[model samples]
Target chain A: MSDTLRPTDSQSPQPVQPLLARIKRRSFFMYAGATAGATALALAGCSKDETTPSSAATNVSFGTGDASVLNYAYALEQLEAAFYAKVAALTTSPLLAAEVPYFAKLATHEAIHRDFLRTAINRDFGGTIIPDLTPKFDSIDFTKRVKAATDTKLGILDAAKAFEDLGVAAYNGAAKLFKGSVYLGIAGQIVSVEARHAAYVRDLITPGSFATNEGTDVLGFDRQLTPTAVFAIAQTFVEQKLDASTIGQ
Target chain B: MNFFNIIDLLAEADPDVLDRFSSRRAVFNSLGTVAQRAALATSPLFLGALFQKAYAGTASLPTDILNYALTLELLEADFYRQFLAAGQIPAGAAFDAITVIKTHEDAHVAYLHDAVIKAGGTPVTGSSTAGIRFNPSLLPATYADQLKYAQVLEDTGVRAYKGRAAELIGTDLLTPVLQIHSIEARHAAHIRTMRGQQPWVSIGDDLAADANYKAAYTSGVASSTRTTVALGGTTYGIPAFNPAQPSPQESNLQQGAAGTKLALLITTGIGSTTYLPDDAAAAFDEPLQAAEVLDSSRAGGLLA
Candidate 1:
């Protein structure tokens, strides 16, 4: 009966192979393992530096939140305070009889801002952020008020203008990052004062220059700067590394 | 099988499904990638569109914009008034200086209002907006609060002029705005000094934390970088203007270097030499445009 069944070609069916099925399953497993391993590695890499501060603190890195923003402002304030204090301590000129009082007042103001920011950071974030600063004042002759007839004893005025104008733009650009209304309100008040300082300094250097490009932006608008851009400049004076990846995130 | 034939067979077997699939696929694919990319590629046009919406729509020149500007000045005026009233300003030589600064802000409000009126606008009357009103909630009811208020007002004033200076360019009322703008800067310096802050803290510091102050100061220093001395020459590394753009009167003045030289001269000390050169005597500094002035004034000028 077996021989008869094998001999009947029309009634016999073709044998199906199981080898291909085994190969397909093995391939699928291999791909799955690779994908799993890749995903695991990715997660591990992402979590490695989650909270630890970077080792190179002098590299001028920033954290990715409001703290970075404050650090930026603090850096600028430090630079300004330092410059004005230098000017106050060493008057380039006799400092016009009327200008002495003005400079002295400005000196006190800068000190307050510098200390206030330092205190705020310490109190609110518990983060110590006073960085060592080295200003590049080789371009400026602090000792001489004027080297030429066209040049005036307006170095302090010019320096003041640059700082005030920069301050105004920095604050305006940062206004959006503030989440709390109270902080926003405080920022608003501070920016106005900075603008006023910009105008005053510009006018001092050039009468009728205030509010103009000659004084401010001739186009009649305030300037704006992104955190990244502002930080780049601030990095110059700062010796310590600030990891600002957390700013405005 | 040929690719086309396979496609044809699939279409024939389920024409309805293929049609629906293709139509849906087209929509999804279009939505998924090309739309945003296309929009970004046309960014300049998009920016122009955005500018039009911001500056040309019915909502353009909104009252909020003006109110914001006026509110900044008002806040500053109030801070100085409060300081003067509370006797926070020390009596004696320093008091006179503070008083002069306080008066300057009052004058700023008056002149700012005048400019607003000239532009057919109304001055802000009260502080109702959350941003306009100080959050008395944050203060600890100490003199610190007062100092904080003073700092806020002074900073705001500095930014306000910076924010609005562009809008005021080429306008008839720009002169007054400029006057106020300078006076506000002086006030800011005075206040910063009062608050023990640096008068020029914001210059060249990009990472500055305060948004309002940064925005007003660092707008276009790199791109349209032009610096001219009063003595008719370029200051720093900035280039001088071409003669082609000079006005007719400027052309006549250009015939003689003396006029241009006089106009460009910068005086070092406060003396008779401080005067602009004879050729520049008739040359009034260009004023800001009304719209620009308004827009800047509103964009949190001193207050931002």
Candidate 2:
């Protein structure tokens, strides 16, 4: 649980020391640069009260230890469940008649996943579970699929595919971070289901593309992304600012 | 009270600290009356001796675990070899998918063979490796049948890796095993897609005809190895090897060491109102035991 993300005075070399100790020189610079950018963004967004550092407002710290890892997963599950719930709610949409019910099933699975992680965290690390997050889906244009990649909003299928793939990578990367065998076992149970979901969604986007290099690597391994990299992409779809500085600490 | 409280606190702080003590529960369950009383009076020396005795017969070496994986990889590779060599596979996307999967399985065999050798263990080979040879008799005749059989093998391979993962924890072997395990899952999903089925395990997955193929979903060894018991009047099937950790079945409502039932929606408290019973169980895939995996491969006629 290093307090590495705390806003520090540039004049004093105090806070940077622990950052230097914990991370490599290259990673240290990257984190410091991101924090500096966060500071600027926060300053621009806040009102006339220039005295307060908006670091707390802009960033959602994942905290530290195994509990932090669980909270990180819980946060992702919340986003996925929220996204599929929205898709399932669409009454008249471009999605095929046959495919609509499957979305409802996917929604249920993600909701069950969200609730499962919350209960696991509450039982294993009571009072440490992160609060239920508020979702932001303004960017998703659920009505139609846009051909251009640069469009601000994504079609439902496009969004579902991205979320499923990201979730699989998140679980794959986070699997080794769990210290307890019980938590590790639970992670293993959920990750394969996510992979299955990813494959199914990918095929819906393009038949026979399932498990290809688009989703899996050239070596035929599924992608594994660290929390820092995952949240960088994930935070855009989410309104709640997340800080993984202490995750798996 | 003080001693028990201390144990509880230590267990909470770092559960591995109490691993030796927890392991004692399994040993005690099987110990005779005289031996059980003797174990209770444990000095440090006696406990250490008891611990060694407990693990000596049961503990699987890292080498053994790696070789076990290597054996499965060989089985899969050989199956694909027969598949590609069959010469009747129709040309198209489905055929290409099988080819890609076959290439990956070959690479898996290569990687595991080298891994086992590097870990100071002899990699079991097809030559003179008496029990682990491939049997091509069960290779399906038609393209559709081949795809069905492929799905079964890939699903079994995924579950087999998951079954042994707990044994590899805290070792250098875990990362590679998991890497391959995820790939196997991806392979299983795509194969299922080619067969026009849902990627996730459907309730009562009726893809294969053999009753034993259900072992891919739930696996247990012969009944003689375990005594039958009932939980809330429902009789539970017992496993022959490692009775303490029975293989998980797809129909299992419970998950993790806490045994939380996802299907029950205990956390949500809405019960099956929001969540269907089948989808709740379908959401999580279960692990298979190594003994059960062996049984599956044998049944598929892939093991000589």
Candidate 3:
């Protein structure tokens, strides 16, 4: 693996280069900006008072090759890590004292995973890692143990399940794109953990419901969602239009 | 001669270089006669030709794979039933759990077999007259021995199913296969925890205790410790990592080749372990040629 910790300074701040080598860099950026602006305008029009930060307005682009997949994972991890971190920072009612440490540990794990992907892409792919995602959790009520009519409902357990389930399906869906066995093995390891997390969270929702047919299909595999399918669900949490056309680019 | 020397040598080598060497050595060591047969059967570059033939069509549908998969579940069901009937499982909560698990396996077999027939495939039938028994030579002599063996069997089953999930994806049978796979993982986890292992720790967890635990289960000896296995002068050990405190690569096992030479040691004697059972091989799970399952009397051991 490349040295992900010490990202090359030259590649840090430059705006993302379009994947097509023949396209003029300036024209590509202009097109991306226009597309993003249009998307943001449409989003703004839909929710006039929505307080989505301007920083979260960029178009989600996959750079090239495996880095794109990594970024996809990174983005999901960002949503998850952020939610868990918030949960860990703010305690809620009916919080089992023993479960607090577990959530904290999950937060740390997600942070590490997020950083690891960022560093790997920076070091190996020589690209600017996608910026830290700002989640739109304005709707979630972190203060309520149960979902209140007023709150967004994006808590630790809910976020964990969504992220874990999405992560498993994403990896499963994307595993075919990876030509390298090393990548596949790494994916295999990650998905199993994701599956474990899925099981744990499923059990949390309903005890012993972890490995049942209800969540997974008949073959005992986790439900796999196509990129388009997952992005539809994820777009709710993120402010940006994740352009996954270049996913396996 | 020592652990440090081995680590030093391994540390200097790049991952790809090590991977290549491991692959080549695995071919020469394990694929000896079979490799020769495969080579002779096809033109030059037989391996590529073989893969081309194997993955020829998208027609390797989920239903077809599941029909074949039902065979594996049936085999496990038979194995557990025989073990139960032979009074192999110890009398305790463990035994009660094993009985419950056996019933689940039976249910899985029935479900899969029914699905297979529904999908226009033959329902796999195990022999009532031709009983398939565990290798008495490899099994433990006591009740704890039985528990350890069952634990390892279930754990291996869990990994095996998971390892094949990708191939089954996008098939009609994907849901059923995934359902079974998760249950198998759950069963493996429950059995492992019953054997004084952590409930959350997967058998594939590359932790220090994992190796020790695997060794104990395979060998039926509590004194077994985590140790590296030597293959062609290279040693591989399960590295320890806490899931809650994952390292950079701890969350993912670093990728290797599509087919790398990784030895799965199954303890045969008190200390010596062998490879996984022949029936456990991926080739056996696929539809076999006439020569593959020639024994009419031993159909239970082969098909079901």
Candidate 4:
């Protein structure tokens, strides 16, 4: 693209607002700047999420190459989808009535991620998507919103925080592994939403506690965990014996 | 290697080189005997990139990107600095949160300042630099008004990072850049929540709804084609705006590439009447072109 075509934002052509009041920094939709994209909303689109994940690959290995990086994401999204689906399903739970809708919204997002990755992997990589393993919820008490210090079972919020934080870190860490820019771009699309989710959950657990976690440091950098480290913690919630050692190699 | 001799050599080469190295504490050992430059000299994104730039006098994609990032960090750090000095922050969580966000912005400025130099480029300065300013005269006087700017800055920070992130793919720098990227998102979420909105960018979120703030959500580009970035002799392109999917507008619902966007509330529902345009819009944040970032009222536009 030539300089004539590019928006000369840095040139300061517009009138100055008091203290740059006109400057709007929100960048949620950076690529889709057209009404054409808006019109497509009415059209029926991508596949709905599979309600039941397959149990085919018990010892799943997200194989090498760019495919491995994607599979790693697929695994995490699957786990989150399952976790939130259960949270949303609670006929009775510890969550406040007002807070319930948030979890419901979360369920849909996770399911979308799960299905999107599943389809993309299957389409682009041709059957490279790993089988979705069953989640292990023995340690989580579905009835509780948060666990007390003495309690053994984890609360709903506890798991949500863990999953969202892990998801952000996993994406952040996994970006370098992608050889191609397209998948890396797609991963960037998803990870910010995960960070938003993580922030929201953190605030829920402790008000005003957003962005103050140990995963982030004084330098304001969030955590970036390699696949092996991510999988070690992720293993606790799933029954599958998955190996992520080769991911991003 | 003798530490003093190395420092002497470095100081001889450039008197301010030590100041440019931000991690002096980390560079030195308990005995202060280690060859400090050796640790950084081996890191390509650091000294190696700089050496090339110092001699070649040419900027790579990463250097340009870092300078772009540094410009904003300086702008943001200054915004909060003025806001905090004003002393109007509410006494509870708001105060704490703003303080933390300000700290992060400052850290970002410091971190990027050093990174830019280490990458073999001149670090962009705050206020005095072109396209970046912290105009105290322009700052909103009231806390409520300042929060609006804060929200805009934080969210813009997230988008700016995302827009340029693809260039860093496959580099060691992607991780740290991503680390910063997620924090920006976290800040955006918090600022939104503090503003009485959802943590995520919902369709027609108040900022987007406002005519003045609309650019915050849209790509500010007339075309759907994204600008590519040159990195390490490779150029990377973003998938074009799939008319089959959502556009860069915050309200666009369908998400994904040309043939594969999933229509959430429009086509499939999660059995909830509460399924909203907001959630669908919030699910996927777009990775816009650096040029698409608008001037005067949007992310990249915030400069100057």
Top DockQ model: 2
lDDT of 2 at B149: 74
Q: What is the TM-score of chain A alone in each candidate?
A: 0.66, 0.76, 0.74, 0.76
Off by over 4 Å in 4: A1-57, A215-218, B1-60, B127-131, B221-247, B258-277, B300-304
Docking class of 1: incorrect
Using lDDT as the measure, which candidate wins? 4
Model 2 error, position A50 (Å): 16
Using Cα atoms with residue i matched to residue i, what is each candidate's TM-score against the true structure? 0.39, 0.78, 0.55, 0.72
List, residue by residue over A191-236, the lDDT tens digit for candidate 4: 9999999999999999877788573354698998888889889989
- lDDT on C-alpha atoms for all candidate structures: 0.45, 0.69, 0.50, 0.70
If both were scored by DockQ, which would come out higher, candidate 2 or candidate 3? Answer: 2
List model 3 lDDT by residue over A106-131, tens digit each.
66546545554565556555664666
Task: Give the Å error, residue B230, model 2.
Answer: 35
| Candidate order (DockQ) | 2, 4, 3, 1
Candidate 3 structure quality by residue, lDDT tens digits, B165-277: 55543345544555455466556556555555433442233332454233311211122223222211222222221234222211122222223333222122112223222
lDDT per residue (tens digit) for residues A1-249 in model 2: 234543354423233334344444466456657674533533333435334432224345577878898999999999999999988887786788778877887998898888877876777688787767768787789886432576777888888888988888888777777666667777777888888888788778887676777634646567888899899989877755666777877
Model 1: what is its DockQ? Answer: 0.04
